[model samples]
Target: MSVDGGHRRITNRLFYWMAGGCGFATGVVGAAFHLAVDRLLQWPHWLADRLGTGPLTIAAGAGVAALAITLAYLLTRYIAPETAGSGVPEVEGAMEGVREVRWRRVLPVKFVGGVLSLSAGLVGGREGPTIHIGASIGAALAEWLRLDKLDFHALLAAGAAAGLASAFNAPLAAVLFVIEETRRQFRYTFRSYVAVIVASAASAFGMELVGGTAPQFRIDTDALPLVMLPLFMVLGAALGVLGLAFNKTLLMALDWRAKAFARVPILYAVIVGAAIGALAFVMPMSVSGGERLIAEMPVADLPLKMLALIAVVRFVGTMASYPVGVPAGIFSPMLTLATTVGLIFGLLVEMALERSSFPVPPLTGAAFAVAAMGGLFSSTIRAPLVGVVLAVELTGAFELILPLMVTCVTAHVVAQVLGGRPIYEVLFERSERLAGRMPSVRSAVTSSPVGIDDPPRSETR
Candidate 1:
């Protein structure tokens, strides 16, 4: 018994070391992929400036964008279908043992495909894809090294936390995100928790080394007015409704595309790509994933009418792109929409309160926008704690915790009243259906009886 205990201790230490190393590597690679996509997206603007605008120039730009998006979509459909649309669901499904993590194919496909789709001005973000891909990489490495099933799961979660940390530079939030968002199926343990924290910290450090540290969004510190709380509650309610509609529309669109273009994913991709390209030419702001738009909101000072129009267009574009099976995320686009709505609401409030000579603080709306971001996500996904932590971490706005809680809780309550289920739960159910139709791999790993008090198998040693 003494000898056995000593051996177990040694094994545990080794597992921790491996998990840390894999987490660090995942962080570095995921950060690199994000930076590369950013640079690639800027290339088109540089090219347009160099070549004088004419029919030929316009046609060339459109053709390039279309081809790039189509190719990206095709790769996602053919090579790594699971990498499609904000891979959070995929990760959640994998955690539940309802989906397989084919890291070998998924990592490369998601990295390259995500870059292409975003560069071509598709409405999406890299956060979801990065997390999914990073987790797969961890899982693959663990399997290759013949790690135990528990350690494999821990490392996978660590990699996922690292990816989000690297992408958003939100270390604490990444850890909280994994814990809160994936609470149901994630085999949580002390070792896994520590692994997630270590990975997130390393990823944040890596991002700072490469790009320098800056919060994802900058906002002035201002308390939300008491009067505005009611309005915010109203906004939260509206977002709850919008969240439900968005999910339904997105799933329907994907289902329709699958049926209409059965076995012809390539052709369907081309059509979606062309539509995005055309939208890019016409409503440039609405074409992309909305990152640039969000960054420029303060400077633009868009009027209510224009903001309303943009919000509508963005909603449609996001729905179309996401359901078409593209490898992208909805986080950035949702932020964009929230910002638009918040700004419009602020502008109207400013007009009504014209009696005050003080400059209408733009930060008020920005704060609400930030909070609404989490609120919508919480409402749709039913992960309030994750939403609050994610928003705080991504934005680096610790002061807005109260507002975030308020908004998220309000939105969640309203969504629940509307009878909406969590988005990931729905996806997991879908994955279970698929899993049931496939062969099981239970023979590959030792069958340890899991008990109520048994630590999740994914924990390190």
Candidate 2:
């Protein structure tokens, strides 16, 4: 018994070492993916600056976008279909034993395809591909290390945390994301939990070393007064409605594409890519993930009509782009949409109070922008804590934590009360049906009402 205990101790230590190594690899890959996408995205902007936004520049942009997106689509459809879309659902499916992570194919395909598609100014985020990359690294390591089934599963979860940590440089939020988002699939042994923490820390350390430890975006704002709590709650409720609509529309679009582009899907890619690429040349801020837009957009200075127009365009852009079967994520796009909507609300409130005795702060729009980031995320993802942590971490707005909490909880409650399913679960179901592992009892792209506390109804898992 003593010998057995000693062997177990050694095995545990080795498991931790493997987890750390896996996390470090994920961090390294994620950093490379981020840097590559950023650098590649600069080429178009540089060209457009020199050539001006004329018909030629627009045509060039369309051609470049078309080529990039077409290549990305081919890679996913022919080489690795699992590399398509936000890989979060695929990772979730893997955790539930419903899918396999083909790391060998996924690693290269997701990296190249993601960089190409994202650089082409597609409306998506990096977090999804990064998370998927992290999980693939974990799977690769697990196989190479000959880990047991349980250890392999734990390592996959750890890699997931590492991925998110690397993406936003938010280690705490990454940990919460694994805990809240994958609670149903993750095995919760004490050692497994510790492994997740270690992986997240290691990945964050690596990412910070390469990309600095600053927040992803900064917002200059003062704390909200107690009198504004009710207003934030109202914003949360409104975001909940938006979240439901976004989910429904996104799914419906995917469903439409599955039937409409069944035979010649590449044609669909060309059309979307060309149109968005041209739009990038015409209205550069309207395409791509909304990270730069969130960081640099002058929300306070923009008119209400402009903000409303921007919001609509982004909403439609995200809906259209995700269905193209490319490597993309909705997180950044969703945050951008939420920020625009929030700023719009703030502007309205400011206008209302401008005539009253109550004076509005100049940065009120920014504060609401911060809160709405969390609110919309909570409503759609159904992970209030993850959304709150992500908002605070990404924006460095600690003073607005109370408002963030109020909005996130209100949004989550509203989404739940309205029976809107979590977006990832909805995506996972769609993936399962597409793979022919699950029966299509309902419409391919429509969302069904799911209870807040319900477990995923995947029988194959």
Candidate 3:
């Protein structure tokens, strides 16, 4: 690249490393910020228990949650509308120069709005919004350094990797996710790849420094018999269809919410929050940022009927809470949904296998729950390696790696055969259309050496 000095400038490894440091800070901040939200989540439960689960208590709880969510919605609508659901797509669009990034607006809005939205017991996760916040910081820093858009892209990717690593305490998987899932937008240079690694490791360290070293989930899963390998394939096929249906429902939910928000705006947030607030009273296990619930599910001893009900409601809640332009993510929700489906499937299979002479692992349900994390993620994100590593790293369920591979790969192929694109690609297209632009998702994805300039041909507005 030519510079003002009439000299060629290569990718700056210094700035890349500096971006890694920035990502460390972002991870520290993101972890602490979400930890605050987790603390705040206790207030409603405390108030309810103190006042008793009477009608007045329920009313107060619901009112507070609704009010909190309504305020968050207001910020999103009025301040920075780009702070909405799974900002990953927006970042991808920005990298392609298809969408602009106003880091000044996005950073504060996403952080504050995400905190408020999650605190309201919404069915969302921290990783997505944190990823946005990190990218915003990266972009802002690039501008501060007087760097060009090229450097901005690398820093943005570095920060994003840090965000995921910090949130899940899985550095390697975070890097893989960017390399695989966002490879369509990220221009991978040796410097950029190194930056990603540094950022991911730094972020994980930062998070663990603040939070404890506990895994995201508490499970001691035993290694499964290779004899049951075919079972995992069947499980994968099930999750593939389920993930396809999930994407379809999420898209429809986004459409429904867009119309609702157009008419009533904040009322969409109010109604959803109020309803979920009420539901939380009876099935307290069904609500929250989602990951904790997944971990608790196996140990909770909830009956099959109640478990099914919670899973379905949480699935609907995720569909409802995220797509309404809320400052949230579908990551934890997808894991929660996948875990439930896997648990239920395993339980049913265990019952059937109990009568048969076929040998099955004693901890079948737990194994399935652990492995299904990769399966659903593979289908939705279409990045099997990332999904597998992430699931194992987050849950510390490494005993079933073989099965996880089987499940994730099968699910990925099935989803592809059924003609499902990655969820983020679809979201990117939808967001662009919403903003009065048309871009080719196919060509951009297939293009070599992705770059921001020269967007691929598309149907124009």
* Model 2 steric clash pairs: none
TM-score of each: 0.86, 0.92, 0.93
lDDT of 1 at 20: 69
Worst 10 residues of 1 by lDDT: 444-453
- Residue pairs clashing in model 1 are 150-457, 150-458
Give one digit per residue, the lDDT tens place, for model 1 in 1-461.
Answer: 11232222226566666666766776677767767777777755675688755555556667777799888877887888788777887776676576789988888888888888887888887687778876887787777666655666777888888877766677787887777666654566777778778877877776666663322565444666555667677767877887787777777776777688887767766776777665665568888778667657755767778989999999888877876677788777877787677677667767766767645654666676677777888787776777788777666667778877877888878887777767666655555565576423322222212211223355546
User: Per-residue lDDT for 1-461 in model 2, tens only?
Assistant: 11332222227777788888878888888888888888888867787898887899889889989999999999999999998999889898887777899999999998899999998999998887888999999999877766666677788999989988888888899888888788667776777887888898889777766873322577777887789889999999999999999899999999999899999989999999999889987787789898877866644488899899999999999999999988888999999999998899999889989999997876899989999999999999999998899999988899999999999999998998887888998999878877787823432221112212643456437
Best prediction by lDDT: 2
Q: lDDT for each of the candidates?
A: 0.72, 0.85, 0.80
| 213-260 per-residue lDDT for model 3 (tens digits) | 322666667887888889899999988888888898899988987786
**Which stretches of candidate 2 lie above 4 Å from their native place?**
1-10, 211-215, 298-300, 439-461
User: In model 2, which range of ten residues has the least summed lDDT?
Assistant: 443-452
What ranking emerges by TM-score with the best candidate at the front?
3, 2, 1
